[model samples]
Target chain A: MTRAEAFSEREVAMCTVARMVENGRTYWAAGGGTPLYSILLGKKLYAPEAQYVTEDGVIAPEPMLPYEPMMTMLAARASYRALAWGTMNTAGIYSQLGYMDYGVLNTLQVDRHGNINSTFLGEWGAGGRRMHGPGGADTIAACCWRTILITDQSKRKFIEKVDFISSPGYLDGSEGARERAGLPRNTGPWRVVTPWAMYDYQDRRLRLMARVPWVTVDEILAECEYKPLLAPEIQVLEPPTEEEVQLLRTELDVRGQTTDAAGGWIVWDGEKYIRGGGD
Target chain B: MTTVSEPATIEVLASGTAPYHKIDPDGFREWVRDNKQRALVPKLMTEKEAVQKFVADGDYITYECNYLTRGPNSLLHEIMRQQKKNLWIAGKFTYVDVGMLVGAGCAGKVDTGFFLCTPSVRQALDAGKLEVYEYSNVIMTMRLEAGAQGIPFIPVRSFGGTDGFNHSGAKLITDPYTGQPTVIIPALNPDVAIIHVQQADKFGNARIFGTGISDVPAALASRKVIVSAEEIIDTEEIRSNPGLTKIPYWCVDAVVEAPFAGYPGTVPGYYASDPAVVMEVFASVLRGAVEPYLEKWVFGVNSHQEMLEKNVGVAKLLDMRKRETIRGGLRA
Candidate 1:
């Protein structure tokens, strides 16, 4: 027993995913869709290569326009494939999934006048001038994985569900039922990354999609008060692509997304630890 | 670190209730004389040399459990690692692929590399260094289990309906009623299901408790079964504690015990893995990368004992880790 060994091939293998990507990375974008944002941002984070698949199943890195939607929320109604958040390049390149409070913000907001806001990755005060819109370190980081949020005419307020988004991070409690359950009511496509895993809002329920490392698909399922018709994979998760890793790392570098960064804006816990365990 | 006159015999308990029994390798050689079970094709294999010889390159090897402690320098890891398309995973354990993904920057095919297991495991994938290929066999298994349990397509709204749901491999079927598509996970029937158990008897009933995966299905779905247990008690005791029994005796073809079976593993009750040693390896990775660390930790080892002899046990590592925690960081 005195000479026994610690650490097995199996155990080490489990923790390596979190360790693969070192810190110090950043993602820059005007917002296209969630998957694309994730793919590009993931590259900065994990430093891994990527495999880009076309809508037709042809794997490629160069899909040009539709994936870069003018609006935030979108959905591929037919394949059931969605691009509610981040940079998505699927089917016909629709808006992220979103549902609005008033009538429906289904009408894409055309800001082609180019008044779009620009988010920064450095200190809150490091920006050149005064803040124009709602965005900070992670707010921008969220953009790496988040694409659109259907908002009411009110600038500060936003809706929860997109007619469609890429990842289901938030819900559309824009209406009254939310207060009954103590849920945060929103007016636009709101977003959140629960400790457990990735979430996307659809019709009504929050679908538990991909999970972070160390998190169980069930753990997320249990926490999600609302059950969607679908759930994420039961397994922990497949590893990120090489490019995705690189993207996260690069973004972390520029913005400093780590335990030591952002005044610990995002707290690390048992749930979040699942994604970046041993970090 | 000593070599025996013959490879030591091991025992396997079925479920938790079944009593232990001895598995005679010699008798096993004789029992398999006719090779009647050979017709099924050897799926689950032991670390034994004979079993390794039988495994072919293209076989779909499904053994959910990764003998953490045993795998670093394990011949099976070596064998499985060589194959670009060997399906050596299950619904139980899949943390094994993290290192390769990080080191290689590519998680091989889903079936080839460590696929899906738990949500925590999924986190590592999303973080990167764990995902190489993109196939939804994971959703396949969950749905398959439900299907095997006699349910229509189980509901799963994950992978974000993005490309994941759109993935041809991820989608199992299209829903006719809702006019919405339903993801279908085709039943996974692996060609082989290999597991390292605590013990086994001549008849074949076996069991263990770490993470309950679809061993029953893995065995039943596969054509052949290979049982490697740590100990094998008499058949009568097995009948006494039938509650723990997982596999029936008739299904197994070979029985052998390889104690410390899940070596290099942090087996809850059976073994301990040195956290410091892992930290030691990772310290190197922190200083540089995983390749040198793997080269030394993985390739430097000549045998399991030699590897053990080179480091301390997990308890000591835990103590060191605790002390280091108090110290804040490890000082060179």
Candidate 2:
């Protein structure tokens, strides 16, 4: 546990799925990404009575549904949502955020990730979108510190290396994505961490910063569907630190959760794990 | 104060226990008719003929969860399949934290465009024909609460200035003081609100004892509304449990009965949330092409009844649910 102990196969998948909700990262998947994206965007994600005010001062629903014309360089509806994933906030906005449609991409653009989130390409109309990471200029920005856990919807929670990756944010590469919008140099390339491996953009090519704890360098190399990278060091990525564990127990565990009849609450009383009994 | 002997002999005459409360179908039907004329004239009604009467090209429609069944096909799926702008979902993220949303939605529609909250619903969308639109529930709520509370804006630190959504929209903006591009997701107004519950009166008064809060905002946001329930209880019964009601009768427009509803679905007071079926649906999508799924969930299942009635479909779905429970490692 001290120096990069091998992660149990179980831990790998847990990390992948759990890390998917970490702070300050824009995630793109196939269909459902609104909740994760909203979390990354720092919204108050609640359910049932999410509130929103209209431009006219009338209260609206959760999952803001903004006009497409007003979207930023990234295709944003600028709508707030409080539901879990793909929820509508009280503000009358529906993020309409979905995972990427690889099929749509293959049919529309030559470069799959190019303008992957763009609505102008085809039948996507205005609701189409893609996310760009904080640029290279923001590299080393505390914002760059992030993790994206990728476990399948599988029951076993298989934690394989990233199946694919063209770049940190969009397929155009962070810099190219920024430039497409006339954005400045992106230092946020440092914002590269995935379940299978960690990536750092050094000179246009991605460098494997580290592998998930316990996973072999070779395992990472083969699992990824992206352009391969050689390890800068034979080192593995740091596993969940004791400090993080403590933080997970004390600070993060009780953020927005509850208990039910089948299971109890997940409460951290500064010492041990409290399983479901609603006590 | 009667005499002791008199009370002993006749107290039984004063016994105040009412025996049974059978539904007055004829009277209830009359009340429903009146409600239909007044509340449901232009508004959508739950009557099969009425619902079928006003079909629209309007992409979004609301449905109650009670009438909705699981297995990737349900009433919501029917509504979703009707939409042309690609289906975007906004609701509770995980059914139970085992994974994500897989109830009535997963088995209902196929090959249709699906959008999800980036992190929460990402799994369901990925395994299907979906596109990801990353938006924050936190920021959106802050804004909605701000709006609901009548504030111009609410300052927050959730996922601030992250890429793809930095200064993203009317809801998200930059704080001049901090220069941090904050997300300002505006409150949403949905096209329709579909909600489910355990009981409702001839009037729209509904009684539920679980988490039905999310439907409120969604219903308030939408232009149209639908309420599905397990039992059309008496108005007195619904009124008796007014405190337990999530959506009041006035807030509701139409009520339809869908018993044993929330199949492969959850309506809180009605049933427990299940994730095993959800994982299997996702796994099934992973196993095959979305085309067959589209055909089966969309073309194959026409209504919630059909989805739940199909033995093969329900069997496959239930198997997945069972397996997911087993894999969850809940046994300790």
Q: What is the TM-score of chain A, computed separately for every candidate? A: 0.30, 0.36
Best by TM-score: 2
Query: Under CAPRI classification, how is model 1 graded?
Result: incorrect
Interface RMSD of each: 20.0, 15.0
* Candidate 2, superposed: residue stretches over 4 Å from native: A1-279, B1-55, B61-73, B80-134, B137-168, B171-183, B208-213, B266-302, B310-332
lDDT of 2 by residue, B113-216 (tens): 11222332334444554433333333333333443343344543332223323223333344444443433334433334556655666666665432222455
Per-residue lDDT over B176-253 for candidate 1, one digit per residue giving the tens place of the 0 to 100 score:
443333334334444455655544565667755323334555555443456666567666777777876777665566
TM-score (chain A only) of candidate 1: 0.30
lDDT of each: 0.33, 0.33
Clashes of each: 160, 113
Under CAPRI classification, how is model 2 graded?
A: incorrect
> In candidate 2, residue A245 scores what lDDT?
35
Q: Residue A160 error for model 2, in Å?
A: 21
Query: Ten-residue segment with the worst summed lDDT in candidate 2 chain B?
Result: B10-19
A153-232, model 2: which lDDT tens digit per residue? 12111112211121223334444543332222332333233334555445444566666533467655554444445655
